[model samples]
Target chain A: MKAEAFLQCSQCKKILFSVEFEQLLRVCPHCGHHHRLLAKQRITATFDPESFEELDKEISSLDPLEFPDYEEKLEAAQAKNGATDSVISGWAKLDGMKVSAAVADFSFMGGSMGSVAGEKITRTLERAADAHCPAIIFCASGGARMQEGLLSLMQMAKTTAAVQRCRENGVPYISVFTDPTMAGVLASYASIADIILAEPGALIGFAGARVSKQAGVSKAPSDFQTAEWVLQNGMIDKIVHRREMRTTLTNLVKMLSWRLVKHG
Target chain B: MAKTWKEWERPLIEVEENIEKLKQKAKASPEAEREDLLKRVAEFERRRDNYIEVMYSRLGPWEKVLVARADQRPYTLDYINSIFTNFTELEGDRRFGADHAIIGGPAYLDGEPVMVIGHQKGRNITERQYRNFAMAKPEGYRKAIRLMEMADRFGLPLISFVDTPAADPSVESESRGISEAIAASMLKMFELEVPSVSIVIGEGGSGGAIGIACASSVLMLEHAIYSVIPPEGCAAILWRMPDKGAQAATALKLTAAWAKEFGLIDEIVAEPKGGAHRDAIEAAGLAKEAIVRHLKLLKKKSGSKLKQERYEKFRKMGRFLSENPVDALAKTR
Candidate 1:
């Protein structure tokens, strides 16, 4: 695979090769800006080729509240992202080691978590537990989807319990944060990972920095609420740039897989 | 940095000093100048009182922010320990290590067994660092979920005191599944058959606060604030400037009074003259009485009944009905 075939940073506008970018772990070598990745691209980058077997792809969203233009928004987001919901979940091999993975698509309503996203994530965790595979989630969201009202908010609880069940089953759950994780989603399961990782510069928090400011809190420090801030506060295990994500995940999967095999 | 009084306090201090100087001069100097000095002293005193009154009465949203963040105010853990007896803290998520930001344990409320949970903020810089500024990591919520489930199992009512600005948003928290922890806590709280009550003692900013707040009844301190997002967040999104948080607060309707008017809160617990910090014991006493009364009443009801009532309470909130006969009848008819 050619390393230079990947997307460029939106801000720095640098075109990057997929292989080269993957080696750099999705970070722009010249600008150091983190670039967004599609769920499919993320899967390919992390897993051995042709190793992905997706689950819960058939499930669709229900507009229970009859929120105005919600159907249209969902349709547009699905078409733009080529996914049934804001998230994609499946089983794949990281350096030939089996693992379950779920990635949220920011293109879909700012990757806001809704009922479908939560259910899909829950199912993925369950599947990983049943298969005895470690579960990995790449979270990118703007928190709960307001269009779904409280139901969206309720997903936080549902997913958290699911992850708990996974832990009880001795399945290791790792959460990887991308840019702009916030609100209900941040408050819930994202914070509970056995191992937490983030892309450099990801805005990860329960509330955005602006909301904190609006609430009369001082402006977050220049590095406030970013992955670095989270690291400083001991909230995350590490901040891995995009380009290093593949190798990092591969190494982590190899270690966990060895443990699982030995235990079995 | 600690030597200087704040800008607002400087004027008051100066006026007070001037008043003292005038009184000393009036006693030592001749009668003619003494009268003038007395008049000047009276004027300064009047100005000082007026300034204090005006400042207290018409605090801007930004000023309210300073008040909420004031370290002198009592945090959730302090109140929990003071009011509730025999709090045996439960630790860990059973899957991961425990989080220090959230404190939960079994306790008795007026001789009745209850679960007490709260966000504990550190008093000083070192403590804040230790507590992660009161923001719960994934384990905090996970720990909360475990304790809540235990309370439900043992038929104990749950009382939560909220004060954190939000959940920890660090990369480690995200990796550990912060969202999942919060979500699980929310789901568990809602489904629990046991009675649950919550009080907002400080900034109930977002899901971090709400995760443990899905209760049968909710109370807020007079000056505490709760909202979907903090004002600064709204400001950044709406005005493109993070500093426009004051405008965002006005629009978000986060104040306790606003929440009560909006029916988001069941009742507002009155604070002391200056605020809760002015009288921590009194404030805690008031909060304890309210909790005891509500818990006592709720204890008589079955878990299913409590759950139903809680569900209905949240469902009925924010709903509006016109008083005009035709408009009121239109929906029912």
Candidate 2:
């Protein structure tokens, strides 16, 4: 029997070959629905070939809380995902424009931001500032990691402070919100960018839809928390398709980089 | 979530109850014995007060969390009433309707004009339901952003009181873009050139707490607990059970003492004996003094300098030295 080399889209349920899906950058060909990608996939699709120089590859989360099964989970995630943690921070070139980049991998523990993930992202920005280059980060997460407890939550402040330094130094920090950006990530650094961009139909919010619905708070519009809905409400700058993302970011970097040059 | 201090402090409360019983007995007893009974009651009261002082000094981390979440504790408004004068409350996000969870407006702190914002929990079930139990909605944060921007325009010092379990995790808040609203508030806060200070009066839970807490000087009440998520939530996630909250609370180090030692907060305001609920006026006084002192220091700096300092201050948090960096590198190999 032939192995199942094809996968089905979660949204449209269209069966497509894995190689074809990879070539399309994981966006559904039939329905145009954007699928969440791994950290490496995001980096490869977003940056020029071999231009990425990874940073802080040695950092991983410690069980500061000594939470049961947490270390085991981290080890299992490392073995399964072939990555250190949820986020991949590095320096990469977008259309030949040098910029520091950090892409979150959703497959790694739902891309939760713990202390290490937060530190890596912060260090990336710090390195970017020292190197005098703009920084861009792709945020795809289910908020703060609960196992790390408050230590995980502090990342929100840590990353936000890092963003603050980038701005103070007149560095352009662009945030690209993809798929599932919610809770602590959205509330802090990911939300405060020089330019905020989102992919089509991303679930972007502070609270989960299910939790909110269970509480019986109030009725929201049908399109609530969707990228388009947030864009209409004027929270994000624009909605870029997966195909046009790299070029659009490249153009933005060129324009913002000039401001840094003129002022410097 | 209720005012259960009587039950929680059985020994002390029982003594107070005994004093009440004795006072009634004295009213009916002969005049000769009344004086002696009254003296006994006074002594008992003194001992109880001392006990409270001792207990407060040695409170466990979990016990502190309980004190931080006590309903009777002074909330944002209570401090505002005692600390500020001539408060003119301004409401609404302008783009949306008003959110009652967060209250903000222009006010005078120590005779100096300032903008005040805070999470306000209610005193009763009805009020809690109305205030969303101090968990802010999207509109609440948007309202905060509007006020922060206004404060920046007028160069008014911004003061915020934090007290909440978390931002309202209601569907309506998410639907209205709660995350974006919080983000906008944080960005606006860091951008503001005016002096900013935050006081954690009670439960400082998660992004809802930090939304209004990104300040140059963040102060927490002695009994207050500030965490990324409530201990119960942390326990449920980590232990896969709700009963392990006490353990989770200890591990999180949510107490003011730990926060100050770790440099997460600038200062720890002393609460009156038996916690802030025992004496709201004294707690408010301490908070006012701390705020005034920080504001004085902050006022000396330029707006650009203030922003830069606040950024640098937060950037310095959570520094650690790994016992073995080689182990981490070897793992990747």
Candidate 3:
């Protein structure tokens, strides 16, 4: 990388050498803000080398609503992100231990859950429940995909019902909240996990802050929806840092899977 | 009494006002002209009814949204009063405070005991404030979970009416973990051993709607609108143009017709001509019939079988193309 190339920390607004920033996995050295990672970056950061096996890679959405410009939008998102949809679904090993995994990337259409994204998430959990393996999902969504409309709304039920499969089978399901997990996704599989973890400083809530104001609720403090603030309020189990996220997931899944085996 | 309606309803209103004028003219005419005037009144009345039937059946997606949100539309409490007997109103989630947005309790369905629950929108401004305009907080969803669990325990058939613009999106709701509260409600409805029926009686908004709507049979009224977000919200977020709500509504395919066509809902309960608001009694009667019919079919299955069937119903919903096999991944380059 060129030494002259620089990146600014979005949170702290401090100039940093791009190579140094990349070395920290895009975590700001000045303010410790963890930059949102692409889905592929999250996959590589968390999973064991060569152990991730993608699932439902060919699954993509259909414009059943014949939504104007939707097809073109989908094409652009695909080309921009080098992926087919907002979510990257598959199974990967955490520190050599297998778990069903699905990582949502915000770069792809704001990580909205449309039919394909919902189908993939549901399939991942179903696979985990069927195989008696632990499942983990990294959630980073704005909400349901408004483009897909009611079909997207139904995914709330579809995915939550999939989570029930895990509950009934006594399988462990974990969800990690990345930056900006809210609305439909948070209200579904993301919140139903056996253990809920969030990255430090991630925005995790059911609704956005602007909506709070629109609804005439008292204005919230700046730290209102932050993971640390929510941790104090008891919405999630832990606020793990980016560097510690893998180890935390590995530890939690190991114990949760062990409990399942003992129950058997 | 006079009724209020949006601009989209002008066609029906014109026909209705004409019928009213013709009836008045018949009363004022002399006996010889009275007979002919009465006949014209009768003819106009028929035309008005027909107009309502056709217009409602052919309403655009955005027009459906307007009707669903119309102040005159019959709400859950109205349906409860008209359809059920021996009604009781329960309150509070017991974990947090009570949310007035959702009202529920054990009620007599015909002569049998059953649980009835729904999002209760306000009929007046003051009441709307108390009801939070039908938007639910974590407490409301929690209260619903309690009602659902009780219904399951008692082996009573559970009925839910979904109506809202989505869950309460506020700091208090977030502080109380509104997301998990709603998710728990969905999980509870999905796993219940007793037969359950959910009707989208009005505006079936996003997570708030789906939370209590995962039932054995999911139905939507003919005029109700269900979507991931309200048309306004969708437009503002997706297009950055708030005035494009009608366009968003069309693109969203939020109408009951679309829901039924996509097989997302079990059936479309017919509202009285115009809407459920126009003829509450007749609309409630039709809803009662649909409920009774579904209960008869659902009541025959054993508990575990019914539960499993409910689970599988939601498990199969989606529209996407899967060109590769699930297990062919690891070996593929």
- What TM-score would candidate 3 get against the native? 0.94
lDDT score for residue B219 of model 1: 91
- Name the DockQ score for candidate 1: 0.10
Encode model 3's per-residue lDDT on B214-325: one tens digit a residue: 9899989998998888778778877898778888888888989889877789999998877898999999999999999999999999999998898777766767766666
Q: Candidate 1 residues A53-80, lDDT tens each?
A: 9876655676654655678988898787
Residue by residue across B1-333, what tens digits does model 1's lDDT show?
A: 111114434665687787898889889989888888888888888887777667656755555555676677899877977898888888777877878899999987777788888898998899998888899988898889889889989988899998887777664565565656676687677678888889989888577888888788899887787766666665676567778776666655567776676456788887765567768999899898888788778889988788667755654432212344543432232
lDDT of 3 at B110: 86
Residue-by-residue lDDT tens digits, candidate 2, A57-118: 76667775566678899899999999989999988998777898999988999899987788
Interface RMSD of each: 9.4, 2.8, 1.3
User: Model 3 over residues A47-77: C-alpha lDDT tens digits?
Assistant: 8988889978877877778888889989999
- Model with the higher DockQ, candidate 2 or 3: 3
- Residue B254 of candidate 2: its Cα lDDT? 79
lDDT (Cα, tens digit) per residue for candidate 2, span B61-136? 7888777877788989899999999998898788878888999999887677999999999989999988989988
Calculate DockQ per candidate and list them.
0.10, 0.46, 0.75
- Which candidate's DockQ is highest? 3
TM per candidate: 0.58, 0.89, 0.94
Off by over 4 Å in 3: A1-5, A260-264, B1-4, B10-40, B325-333
- Ranking of all candidate structures by their DockQ, best first: 3, 2, 1
